[model samples]
Target: MYINGAWEPAESGATFAVTNPATGEKLADVPDGGRAETVRAIDAAHAAFRGWAGLTAYQRSEFLYRAWTLMLERKEHLAQTMTREQGKPIRAARNEVQYGADFLLWYAEEAKRVYGETIPAPRGDQRFIVLRQPVGVVGAVTPWNYPVSMLTRKIAPALAAGCTIVLKPAEATPMCAIEMFKVLHDAGIPKGVVNLVTANDPAPIGEEFLSNRKIRKLTFTGSTEVGKMFARGAADQMKRVSLELGGHAPFLVFDDADPVHAAKGAAMVKMLNTGQACISPNRMFVQRSVVEPFLDELVSRVTRMRAGNGMEDGVAVGPLVDDGAIEKVDRQVKDAVAKGAKLLCGGHRLMDNGLDRGTFYAPTVLADVRPDMLIYREETFGPVAPVIAFDKEEEALEMANDTHYGLASYVYTQNLARGMRIFEGLDFGIVGINDINPTAAAAPFGGSKQSGLGREGGHEGIGEYLETKLGGFSV
Candidate 1:
């Protein structure tokens, strides 16, 4: 663990093994921290908050820029580490590293852009101004999927906004966080400005985050249940909270769209991270006139994907994070099939072709999927595509919006007017009109409804770590 700019073991000398999801090989033994360790880290962050936040935006930007450059220089190493621990294809891991590093650069420039405003005063000789100041110490928790990007998405903004932070990375992927902090430390971040705590069990650390008065904000990226728990805990303190949680995004393919193009986009995005993404489209709504063509194209692309260890060459799909992920996905597929969905292709676990050791599942495609099925309502964080047929635009729109989650929704239509209408109608934080990859470092990424609270990335990201102080003066 990295705490107070020092590498240390748990006070109890307890450690937990980090294994590769692809091979089940022990990667490393990380310190097992609990509530006590969390308090220590939080104290350090509180002590350093004033000094860190005292730095000018330009000075903070220099530290961020240096870290960004160092991250790029070690991009290959970071990618390999992520692939080993997180079970993503090496190619995808590399792309994620690139994507994650971009956040540092983006926020480095944004550090100077935390703008304030001057308000007109009603009375003579009275003036009012609003200043954006850093919120105090922050506590953050990140999930395993997209481990590197998720950490950078939170860390870059907090540091850029001049807030000290204590992070608890997901237990399944602590090595990635350790390596990332190495880069930040090498870039000359001050002591106690950033801290990382790894724990086998996360409950105690989370409790400390809520109970500790020094922690002014809590940022989390994980399951909806856990995010809600954090939200409830933070209510007592009224600590600033930002959550990026679960998503069951819907992909709408209208009849006017070319079936082949839409299918390719859907397959590509659905299979990303083996479909372990908050924004991964969980339901595919196709106009009835083009359902057959879309299914045919989607099936072909999905079946052609190769599943194996992430480090191996030519492997497209990698193992799921663990047995639990495999079971959840398998259960969803079986329920969908039992409920009358046609299994077009790749419906079972992939144990053949030298894949028996890892938790690998086939890239599945299902057609004639109904809302009664489990996959329709739940997120199958695996490479399973369920296609639902729709007749009219209104029906498709209604089905798409009929979900508690509102993270990301994709629409494909050649008609400009129809695309615009659907884009406006979709009740999601991000609406991709004829685009599958909607998230960017320059744009806001988050959700509404039960999906999550607050945004990550873009100009709004840094705002989460800042407070607005209105100054009123009479001269």
Candidate 2:
């Protein structure tokens, strides 16, 4: 763990092992963060916010630019670390590095672009001004999947908004954040502006941090349940919160949708991070006319994708990050099958015979999924996708919005008007029309309902870490 601009172990002198989910091998040990250490990080961030948030936007942007350059210099190594810890394909891991670095650069430039306003007052000797100011220190919690990008998503925007951050990265993938801190330190970011801790028991650690008044804003990307807990804790101190949580996104394939091409693209995005992605398509609703053809092509495409070590070339799917994830996927498949869903292709674990020795699962395809099945309603944060068919667009949309989640949804249609209609009607914060992937660093990415709150990315992301102040002066 790195806190207060210094790299240090947990104050308790305890460590947690970092396992390579690709091979089920222990990679390295990271510090086990707890309440005491969490408070240290909080205190450091609290002390630093006064100076850090007060810096000119230009200065903040310049420092972030240097950090961005530093990130570029270490992209490959960081990507490898992410792959080793996260179990995503090396290519995908590298792409995350590039995209994460791009966010850093984007937010770096955006840092200097935030402007306050001068407003006219109706009364004589009264001048009004509006100011966007940092929301003091922030407590950020990120997930394991796409570790680098998730960390960057929080760090880039918060830093750009002139807030000092004390972040807790998932224990499953800690090295990526450690590497990020190294980049910041190498880039000469002032001490205490960024803090990190890796802990298996993050809730207590986070609880300790949220109890502090100086940590005024909270941002998290993880399970909806966890996000809710964090929100409640932050609320105790009246801390503002921005959460990007769970999703059971529907990938609707209309009759007008091209099965062959749509399958290819949808599969790519759906199976991302082994389908552990919060925004990954889980409940797929294909039109009755296209369901059979889509499944046929989709099954073939998934079969062709080589499942192996993330570091290897030509690998399409990799491990599930840990034994727990693999076991969870296996249990879900069994449960779904017992409940009546038919397995079309894969539904079992892929032993690490040649693809390394971690936790790997086959890319599973399920059909005849009913509304009663748990997998139909729960998040299949694995490579198991249930292909559900619908006849009417209304029914498709209804099934799409059935879950408590509303993070991301996909609608594919050849008719421009129909596609746009479905896109606008989606009950999601993010809608992908004729596209399986929609998130970009340039736009706001969030969800409605249980999916979470606020936004991350673009202008909205920066504002999440800031407070608006209206001031008046008598002229």
Candidate 3:
């Protein structure tokens, strides 16, 4: 890890091994970063901010644009790393790298537009301009899923806004990000401007940056419970926090919607990251009049998908992150079955081609899933989706909003009225109407309720890196 222009081992001299969730095979070793390393990172960022912030917008933007181009040139290599570490299909991992670079490209252009506006004063002799100044050093904590995109969502915008960063990526998927940090250095981001650390135990590492007064802002992406705990910890020191927390997103298919299209679209999301994504559609609420048809279509589409290794092309479902994820989802499935849900397809472990030794779980489908079931209430984070039916729009809306999570919601309907109504009523940070693809580098992404606080992406992303300053001047 690089801290203050030097790569060093952890003060504790402890290291953790990075393993492929697909096979539980060792990929590489990284530092077991803790408070000492985190403090060093913060100190480096604190020292670097002035020179980085003082650079002209055009100059800074030029460097960022260079970074964007570099990312595109090596997209495939980065995607392979993502697949190996996080267990997402290579096709999806490719998209993650592309989208992650898109953030850099967007913010490269946005850098020049980080503007300050002059205010009208009652006295002609007095003048004022509200400046959006950088909020000093920042501490970022990102999850294993979408490893590259999530990291870039915070890093790109913060760089555009002129804040130095200390990134603590999840140990499970650290190689891609560590490589990207090196890419930044090659792209002309000065030493000490961005530092990265990875470890199995991030509590202590994050605490260092979180507790430090020099680190003025924080950004995180992960589970709601952990995000809440960290945010509370940051609050103790009055640090600014931006979190992209967990979700159990609702997929609502109206009776008026085309069953085939809805099924195809919903299945696409369910298989995304093996359904490990936070904004991924976990709960399916179909109109009762069309429930049977939707379920039939869903089963058909999913049954057609080829499940295998991520590196294997034309495969939709990949292995879970590890045996733990497989066991957790398996247990959730068993609980749903015990709770009276019917197993539509796929309800057991793999038993072939060395797959049994790996973390592979077959894609599953559950019918008649109740709201009270753990699969319905908790995040599965694997390839399994349950179908629930509702007779009325009100009932569907109530069911959609039932969970504490309000990250992202999906709606498939031909009726614009219904889509707009659902958009307004479904309490979430973002809404995907008739589309499974809810992410874009240009749009703000995050969540509501316990999902998260603040937002990431577009100009709103840059906002998190800034603190408003009102200068008092008289002429």
Candidate 4:
């Protein structure tokens, strides 16, 4: 753990092992941080907030820019470490490192653009000014799926907006967080400005974040159920919160869409983190006329997907984070098949090819998945694709919007009018017309309804870490 600009262990001398999900091997032991450690980190951030917030935006930008450069320079090491810890393919991990670095770079520039505004008052010789100021100390809880990207997404904007932060990364992937924080420290981040605490049991740490008066903002990226708990805990203080929660994203493939192209795109996105991503296409709705062709292309593409250790050559998919994830995926697939859905390809867990000890699941595709099936209602956070057919545009739209989650949705269509209509009608915060990955450092990333609250990137990202002040003056 890094707290108060120094690396330290837990006060209780306890530690937890971070395991390699692909092989179930122990990677490294991290500090088992709890309430005491969390309190120390929070205090450090709170104490450092004045000095950090006092620095000019340009000054902050310099540190961020340096960190960005360092991240790129150490890209290879970061990628390897991420692959070891998070189990994504080396290529995917490398891309994640680059994507994470972009946040630092983007925020470095954006820091200089956090401009204040002046307004004229009705009274003679009166002036009004609106200023955006840092919201003080922040508490960030990030998930494990995209550890590097999620950490950067929260901290970059917070730092750019002049707030000090105490971060608690997911227990399953703490090495990446520790490594990134080292880069930040080396890049001249002020002592105590940024702190990190690793803990397997997050409840104690989370409680401190909620009760600590000094922490003005709490940001989290995880399940909606956990997000609600944080919201309730923060209610007393009315603490500012930003949540990027769960999603059961819908992928709509219209008859006009090239079935092969659409299938290829959906497969690519769905296979990212083995479809564990919150925005991964969960329910795929295809126009009935094009269902068979789409399934053919999708199954063929998925069938070729190679799942094994991330370090292996030519591996496209990797193991689930743990045995529990594999079990959940297994249960969903079995239930779907029992409920009359046809298993097109790769339905069972993969144990051969040196994968017996690891948490691996075969890339699965199910056809004729109905509304009542468990896979249809719940998120299949694994390498599974469930295809549902619809006859009319209305039916497709209705099926897409039936879920409580409104995080991300994809529509594949050649017609501009229909695309625009679907775009307007969809309830999700993010809509991908033909694009699988719509998230970017320069755009706001968030969801509507149960998916989440507030945004993570772009100008809006920085806004979450800032407070507005209005001043009136007579001259």
Whole-model lDDT per candidate: 0.94, 0.86, 0.87, 0.93
Query: Model 1, 168: alpha-carbon shift in Å?
Result: 0.4
Model 2 accuracy (lDDT, Cα): 0.86
Give stretches of model 4 more than 4 Å off: none
Note the clash tally of each candidate.
Answer: 0, 5, 0, 0
TM-score of 1: 0.99
**Local accuracy of candidate 2 as per-residue lDDT tens digits, 1-475:** 8888888988878998888877767889898988888788888888888888888889889988998898888989998998888888988988899889888988998898788999878998899999998888888888888788888888988888888888888888888889988998888888888998789888787777678777889888999998998888887878899989999989999898788878887788878878989989988888888888899988998877778888988888888867778777888889889998889888887764665466778898898888988788888789987888899989988888888888999888899988878888888999988777687888899999999999999888898988899999977
Query: Residue 109 lDDT in model 3?
Result: 86
Model 3 stretches with alpha carbons more than 4 Å out: 11-13
lDDT per residue (tens digit) for residues 51-162 in model 4: 9999999999999999999999999999999999999999999999999999999999999999899997999999999999999999999999998999999999999999
* Tens-digit lDDT track of model 3 for 315-406: 78878777788889999999999999999988887768767656777888898999779999998888898999888999999999998898
Positional deviation of residue 456's Cα in model 1 after best superposition, in angstroms: 0.6
**lDDT for model 3:** 0.87
What is the TM-score of candidate 3?
0.97
